[model samples]
Target: MHVQGVDGAEESNDGSFVDLRRSQAGAFTRTQAMRCGISDKVLGRGVRARQLQRIHPGVYVDFTGPLPWETRVWCALLACGPGTALTGPTALRKYGVDGDWRDDRIHLAVPHTRRLDRKSSVVVSRHRDLPAILHRTRRPLTVRIEVALLLTAGAHRDVSRRAAVLLDACRQRRTTPHRILAELPALPSLAGRSTLRRILADASDGVQSFLEHAYLRRVERAHGLPHARRQVRATTEQGVVYRDTEYEPYGVIVELDGQAGHADSISRWRDMTRDNAAATSGKVTLRFGYQLVSDPCSAAIQVAAALQHRGWPGRPRRCSPACRL
Candidate 1:
């Protein structure tokens, strides 16, 4: 028996079928096609004719070959049924968060009360407040960037990894610490809530990366070093440059190099030129990489030494039993 059309008219007469397919990146659920007045026999014919590609059981795409990222996303949503939204890193990427947030599996969230079957390359989660977090007006349906950040952050077991998610979201200008802070009350049971709050506070203070957050907490605060100004803007021969951490009164600047290395010869030269310009302006630049920052005590010692040499009277305090400072 043919499924009844949604508007009591065949999709062919109304053009809803084509419109629905286009809106979902050429992917549509079998149920969706049926609601548009397409039959099982018609779908079988389309599949046999190589005009439709089955993605996940009921999900079908108009094109064959490798599926595009957008098509994969649509297929996941269609397979999950209604009220499902893109969540975690998948949602963050949709909101334009740059860097390493991409996932091979499409992450989705539905209302906690609904139980859905699993699909390949799809991770489905249940959220009690899914409706509140979901962006209803947006296509492909996604959780708000703030909620997505929190969800993504909560999924990580490591505190640093969680901090990285929140920081990268803000650093890339996809979301703000304040917006994320506003969404925190909705997820009171989120993992590492206290740590998440602290990181958000640090982000509000212009700490833009996990490395910067680590430096602020482990090195500066732990060692009783003066709080350094973060993202300090300075006009130099290289034009405008922002220093990661600046002790302006002490004439000392700390540059946290998060890159594995100078990415290229141009990056190396740019760094060298910036340091030289700082030197010419009588400012001392202390560079620290991930390895150096891993030992917070050592990093603090160096920073404290630089501050002391620039006429600060304070000495670095030992943070732990193993701390050499």
Candidate 2:
């Protein structure tokens, strides 16, 4: 007999008792099973028959085959009880946000006032003022994308890595930096507020990568250089090429070459071809790498000089004491 709950969970026709398994990735809790008309006797019967496998104290997988990573996550959430939602990398992954997901454990956020059983594969975090809509929306039992990113940011101490995670989340999900900034005040304190605020400001200024962002913060903004247009696309014989940063009025193109993309011969050749094309078009190209982005003062001075030669009429300011611009 098919049954339904007020929460909209339904049962399958095969008399599995708990239909939550279908929606919950083949995992369900004892409370949900009982709510779907499964008695303790029947539950024990299913366990004995191998139709159900206990994963947590009160959670079971409806199937016997090897469980996938997502199923394990689902099992963790179900075991954590209500008012809990996936957070951090787990929730971010659901939103198609890129990050490290091989941690082999699930992260769930519950109300700070509530307590849950400790499980080795599950990390239960307590949050004050857990946003209600994160779990109430169509993407039930999981935090929102921005919330997940914010939470993930709070866990990371390295500023560059944190910026990469947040920026990549924005890039992959096509979420606006303004939306993230607007929500920053309401989020629980995890990341350093001042640092996050700085990164977001740089992001709003059109910095896209860790390197590009560093150049903006440490070189351009810090040294008072002209704000260059970012990720500018230009058409060439090789189709289209994207300049990392560009001063269109001065015809100065700055390319940030990360090792991963510029390491191969093919990539190097393409970069050279694009640089030559820019030169032919009367544009001056300047390329920077991780090292330049790391210690950007010298590179900033060179770019400043190039811009001056192209009639920029502005001098880059010194960023710190004992530093030359």
Who wins the TM-score comparison? 1
Task: Give the range where candidate 1 is weakest over 10 consecutive residues by summed lDDT.
Answer: 1-10
lDDT of each: 0.84, 0.77
Q: Where is the poorest 10-residue window by lDDT in model 2?
A: 1-10
The C-alpha stretches of model 1 lying farther than 4 A from their native spots are: 1-16
Model 1: per-residue Cα lDDT at residue 159: 87
The TM-score between candidate 1 and the true structure equals: 0.91
- Check candidate 2 and list the clashing pairs: 154-190, 154-191
Question: What lDDT tens digits, residue by residue, belong to model 1 across residues 52-84?
Answer: 788988988887788988889999988888888
Q: Which one is best on lDDT?
A: 1
